[model samples]
Target: MAGTVNRVILVGRLGKDPEIKYTPSGMALATFSLATDESRKDSEGNRQQITEWHNIVLWGKQAEIAGEFLRKGKLIYVEGRLQTRSWDDAQSGEKRYRTEVQGNRFVMLGSRAEQGESPESPRASTAQPTRTSPDQPLEEEEDLPF
Candidate 1:
């Protein structure tokens, strides 16, 4: 192909509450850990599950929404690009590399058991619609730059 792609899409549960931060420029940045699992039957005919953890980052207005609506163990679908950062620790003088998913869009999958929230609760407004896929027509999405 003449072009390239750096996209990543994941559906998983949050490992912990998201960490929200603000840059000196006043932009919001939210970071969180997500867990994805795989299940299979072992040779002995027993079920086995494997979980993988991922670091996710959301910036600007998206980060703000993630902070407000997402919580620990909440399932979410995220679409983003993979980014790797390498730096040297100031005190340890050791180089480190980290990979993170830089989210462009997100959708809350809702709490599995709804946290005992009633169907008519006011907090239901916090629920949001799912994200758009690449196959969606550009005209139908919010007017945000890609």
Candidate 2:
């Protein structure tokens, strides 16, 4: 292929509540951790499971939505690109790098009540809709031939 793609898709549970912050220019930024698990049978036929934690970042409207709706242990589907950032530690003066998924779109996979939220709340009703980047066009069910 002549072009390169930097896309990532992940389905996981949030490890904790998202942290929201604002940039100097007043842009919203949110950060959170997601835990993904893998299960298999060991050589001894014992069930084994491994969990991987990923750092996730959301910006703009996505960040705002995450801050308002996401909570610990909530299942979510995230689509974005991997980004690595480097910064110098203030105390050690050492360069540190961290890789995070910069989420462009996301969907809450389960019902709000399952996450300890009220099902009848307005936010709950509105929040379940899959959110995508503003640049992406929304596709309606009628648009599908099937």
Candidate 3:
């Protein structure tokens, strides 16, 4: 009863193209905005639409894949945890707080053709083979000299 969880799952359209940035360490990070909407009948019998915007971030290999495949208006389903960060604006001198989804898993829900991907082609999500080695630990390091 003492455990806590911070998870967020969203299926939405990208508001704009993702921006990829690299740190000094040469790590890849991709940032994008997503929008989700809901429509329902209001008290006046009129349909009302409400939209929520979310900031999404992906790192490492996932970020690279997202940058290459995802685009504006593409519908995607993302499973991630919420993270809040603060930074000082350069010009405004004000503290900026940003909430973002640290995407761990993502699925392209829309048609592959729209993403410049072919339906006949095997995408990364569907192309990868599942791990069958249950007894081996995934984090076990290899003896690479590099």
Candidate 4:
């Protein structure tokens, strides 16, 4: 490999409505939290569902679009790179770090009923998505190297 890849793709529901703000330079900025889920058998052979939370950030027009259309519990697909930023905390005087997905491309997911949109509204709902296409077969556990 000549170069490294730092891409992250997430398909999840918004934990809350996106919050939008403008920079001093008048650029749009949006921030939100997304939740992804996974399920597996525990040591006792009982199934457990786990949810993971991720910080998501969007910029410019994408930020504006996300802020306006994405509501809490809405399903969405975000594609972007992972970034970790560090800052010093004011009260604690300790360095704080945050890892966030700097999403560039966004897509709406799930059916109209799931998104609370009318069946005729295309803007609010979509059939699954690219990576989750039904035509593709899921890889079995044995196929994974780990």
- Candidate maximizing TM-score: 4
* Model 3's TM-score against the true structure: 0.77
State the TM-score for model 2.
0.78
- Please give, for residues 1-146, the per-residue lDDT of candidate 3 as tens digits: 45767668788999999999997998778899999999999999999999999999887777777788888998887766787899999999999999888776677875676667876643433312112235422333223242
Question: Model 1, which residues run further than 4 Å from truth?
Answer: 111-146
Per-model TM-score versus the true fold: 0.75, 0.78, 0.77, 0.79
Clashing pairs in 2: none
Computed on alpha carbons, the lDDT of every model, listed in order, comes to: 0.75, 0.78, 0.75, 0.77
Residue 94 accuracy (lDDT) in model 4: 100
Tell me, by lDDT, which candidate is best.
2
Q: Tens digits of per-residue lDDT for model 1 on 62-108?
A: 77777877789887878777879999999999999999987777777
Tell me which of candidates 3 and 4 scores higher on TM-score: 4
Q: How many residue pairs clash in each candidate at the backbone level? A: 0, 0, 0, 0
lDDT of 4 by residue, 1-146 (tens): 55677778888999999999999998788899999999999999999999999999887777877776789999887877787999999999999999998776677787767777766554621222222224434332222131
Model 1: worst 10 consecutive residues (lDDT sum): 121-130
Off by over 4 Å in 2: 120-146
